[model samples]
Target: MLVGTIMRKIKSRTWKKQRYFKLQDDCMTIWYKSKKLFPSLICVPLFPVSVSDVEAIREGHQSEVLLSIADEFPADRCFTLVFRGRRGNLDLVAESAEEAQSWIRGIRKLMENLENMGQRERLDQWIGDWFRKADKNNDGRMNFREHHARLFSFFQMADRSQSGTLEDDEFVLFYKMLTQREDVLRVFQQFSLDGQTLSQSDLEDFLRDGQLEGDNVQQHAETLIQRYEPSDTAKLLNAMTFDGFLMYLGSSEGSIFNPRWREIFQDMSQPLCHYFISSSHNTYLMEDQLRGQSSVEGYIRALSRGCRCVEVDCWDGANGEPIVYHGHTFTSRILFKDVVTAVGNYAFKVSEYPVILSMENHCSVEQQRVMARHLNQILGNKLLKSTLDGKAAVGLPSPEDLKGKILLKAKKLGGLEESFSGTADDSQTGEVSSGKSPPSYNLKDYSRLCLCVRLLVSYLNNIVFESPHSQKLTFISPVFLFPQKSKQRLSKELSDCVVYCKSVHFSNFKHSHIHSKFYEVASFTESKARRHLRDTGGEFVHHNCRQLTRVYPSGFRTDSSNFNPQEMWNAGCQIVALNFQTAGEGMDLNDGMFRQNGGCGYVLKPGFMREAEKTFDPETPQKRDGYQPVALTIQVISGQQLPKVNIKEDSIVDPLVRVEIYGVPLDQNRQETRYIDNNGFNPVWYDTLRFTVHAPELAMVRFVVEDYDKTSKNDFVGQYALPLRCMQQGYRHIHLLSKDGTSIPPSSLFVHIRITELE
Candidate 1:
């Protein structure tokens, strides 16, 4: 296929220009260039997007900006490339339908290859990417200057005959020097008879002794030799070369995350309250909470990343419409209708599980009604307006029963029986009259208004018939209570949309256990949730098993920073909401937690957390039943192709690795390796770190690489995080990610992991 073509780039309605787009020969990067007066300027780059970075390819003007220009551009010729994480989408318009199809098909094929790439293939690609970056002149060779200072010694050593440049065999020698791992070499030589290559028996011994492979060690060794042996002669002899040995250790077979857990292996049939949901707080804001831009892009980003619950703070807008924003804050606003549309489009694009629209409604009754109409119309059947079954059940429905559905989590008023029984009307009338009633209204008028409100709700209920008569339905009414009332009156139309997760004020665990239904949900600020966890963690865990709980960040975090979600998760809180807009350790932990279970937005809670009989408190993990602690030993061996912390030409990082264990308070700990001065490339550590995890199932292990400094805190380079239970035991490669959780390819740590159960 032709790798390059001209396409019109669409940034906005008025910004559309022809640009040359090219897929590099590596098949991993797509580079584009705008026409310039000088040829030199044309060669200057905008940016190159990696094929693996693309989350999805949306066709036919799926993005808002693209859809806005539909009248000018042909729908068949327009498409959007949605990048992973928080990166903006790339919208382009082809000159012809054929060209658009060709580009789309070609990119899809490349993406498929990326997805199916084996361990060795991925390593080779990573190496090729590094070589390409170092080959500054693009001449298929690297000169001494392009090798950088950290590698200058290796470059000089590999450049035989004082050529000042390396090519072919010479380049291979340089690569070997660049990637040499003394730690792995020492282990390899210890097992090899010739101190060169390992025979099948020798490999088996290493697998049995070093990797702790129990049964069928010989078969596993043979498979590794066959699959990873780069030299054909060694493969024929049932032996593995050092290159092949390293390849095997870097492959998926050597990954820290267990391959079995990579799939959806957990039981997903449990009730919604029993699972930990990936949720977002202030999801509409792209930056800080105080003055951030509110855009529909936020909804798309969160949903596409497998966030099952998103906050939408609705406030009254012009023309009786509702706007979503951080209420009373300086943040910008987006139409509530647009948010609904975005959610409806992208909710099921990544995961088939149900999504919760966590509504923080501050809109007036009129605008609230508009919000309800928009959700009902835009979402259509995707909206869950009633319970799944005709009859009310003892517990909330499972995620399996609510697939592809969107549930509203908002305040609801009195139940249908009470609303139509005259009791509710009398109470509402008295409440309205007892408070500061409007001057135009008399006692008779107040009574009549309350009656009319009840009749209107009953008539709407009869027409919609959202649920069967067997169920006790609760619908919110638009009739506003007087100024003295603490809470805003909810619109019945919007309230009817909330079927499973009815938002309720939380008083105490005892009160909730007595009065709250399975469908009732309570939200807590970080401060309040922390207080509960600190004082009565067992009760908090018990409360979460029956009723859903959402823990959000404190309001004082005006910068939209996130709190550690692991704390809430420790309490079995189903919806631990975080500021998805920010990228830090908090968000990294959030991303790591949700990266498992096939990124399905719902992860089944640990068995102990789900069982009501077990009083497993995060504060006192050792008291839990069957609490078997685990001793985890990790040897930080080396780093490969570590990225520079800054863009300065002379910046040579003194890199260090820190391993952190996050779980119960008892298990939380961190240890670090001594810094390697002036070495970011192939820096060797071989430092061993250990931890005792009290709750392995709830623990997460994080590997962080930072550039050490003498006068200040270390600068972050990259890190990788995953549940400790998913961590594999063996020599493995920890692929590092940037602060934003995007892959920093070729930048990884080589480590050995051993986990032993302690009695």
Candidate 2:
């Protein structure tokens, strides 16, 4: 412990064998602690890891029970710590009731504080905490000089077969214990000479011949001596040494995350519009657009999934405050204040990126005032009240600069007026000029006409209306600019709120190659998006890069079914708004895409999508200049925890594996795995499936395990999908998860992945 820093000590504790100890979020230091002592037991970090709940526990005695790891341990006495990202529970026991209560309060406080932190701060803190707690000795450094015996013990504990070596799945599990990064794993695979297992001799040769990269060559050399080239040969490693383990951890080879790229400076430097934002449509509804309940949980759920943009439809409420719900429908109603509070509190919990509050307002002046007040009070400093430099920016601020801020994007009184300025102003100037216009309407009427009057309470808010793109609080409210003979006269009566956006009913792919700002925010339904994807995908890619486009569910989707977001993401549309309550392939793909880049909800678009001047035709395949075609091979070996679907018969499921390869060129994607029969519990097929693909970077492999049925459709069992880029080259275990993004305990698919470059 640091000298000045203070930590409360528990009064008493039971210890069978203590290894490591530390208090941190997402990870407990037990893994490293055991590595320092003996590597018999440790808790693994779950995927999309999170610390769910913390509560106090007590018994009849003064001591408090924090956890019950043993089966016979009393459940009534322990405080449970529920965590996700891995299978099973990770509970830590506290000594006294006071200690348990203190731990619970501290953990809750951190979780509550997550909302208040800026996006960059939260990510930075999380990364730093992972590294600090991983340094099990608490000596501010990690070294393996004295822990080689324990490292051997660690290797031995995982070598279940006593084959005297660790192969594929065992290797992955062991490497995961060291670091969760895939980049490091790729480099580690280069040392496997036999193309299967890493034996004691291979490890020994690696220790002697491996070249150490980066500063501190002497320390690395000393580490090698303590392990392989020990002065006393009798102390030579039985397996791998602690010094070798520490060398790997300290080397550039074992980076947990990108050491240079994990900071805010690297991610936050791009324009807000440049990022592909994770957004939600009808955020208040839990199930359907009509009958679902409108509550705070919807907002919480959306934000927790890394959604950076959320829609809120507001109207007049019973009390003085405004209310949120679907208009003219049976959907339940909730307070507008409640939604704002929810957004402000949970916005940064999943991602630290800026949140765009897209509000559709239909409220009286009194309720509008109430909304303004609640936004200002509840959100406080988190609300983006002004531009960063206290002056109007030429363009919108970078996402990095707007970190931890809530931007209200609503149709304002006087908004951005670009090429189609107000009639009076345009007529007086004879063109789109930077000059100001006089008040053409009554002031009282202006206040009543504008629902967001208090937020954008000035005539200057009409800059975007006069021009095209406006940097005023990242506001976006596209309107159809229809040409008319009396258009100039009609525009004058409307005053400064001369909306932008030229409506183009895209029946054909014409008028795409043109220079434009965010003047035309094209909106499309799911069917329309898919139509464009099939007919003219290249056109959509070019169109989405230059300007922002939104794709929502079609009107026929009365039940609010969501379309596959990956199809839209492939074309680079930023706002692929889906119904959050719906769970299926569409939502599953959405969850998978945004899980990267610290789950901040905003991912920097690929190089082709970000370059507005450059054109990348989706119709044209990506360049294969130095690349060769790849043949993917997977062996359906065995499965665990195959769920029983036939309850009436009370019989186990006859599970079969269907392996699919989704490639960049649509024609190359296909399913190849054959079905297995009659076995559900530990079924082994040993069947191999193969497919050929051109682009590995733009490909994904999905493993779906389902129960075979002759009379009806195959019942859904469990599924797993991941990018082909991160897949292991040899035998590996594919863990299964339900549609709700939770791990199904013991449900795993053991497979061998073989990738051969087609010459």
The window of 10 residues in a row where model 1 has the poorest summed lDDT is 428-437
Query: Best candidate, lDDT-wise?
Result: 1
lDDT of 1 at 550: 94
Once superposed on the true structure, which residue ranges of model 2 sit more than 4 Å away at CA?
1-268, 364-366, 391-396, 412-516, 519-521, 622-630, 645-649, 662-668, 694-696, 754-759
TM-score, one value per model: 0.87, 0.58
Q: Could you say which candidate leads in TM-score? A: 1
Report clashes for each candidate as comma-separated counts.
Answer: 1, 17
Model 2 agreement with the true structure over 329-373: per-residue lDDT tens digits: 678888898888889888887677788876665566556667777
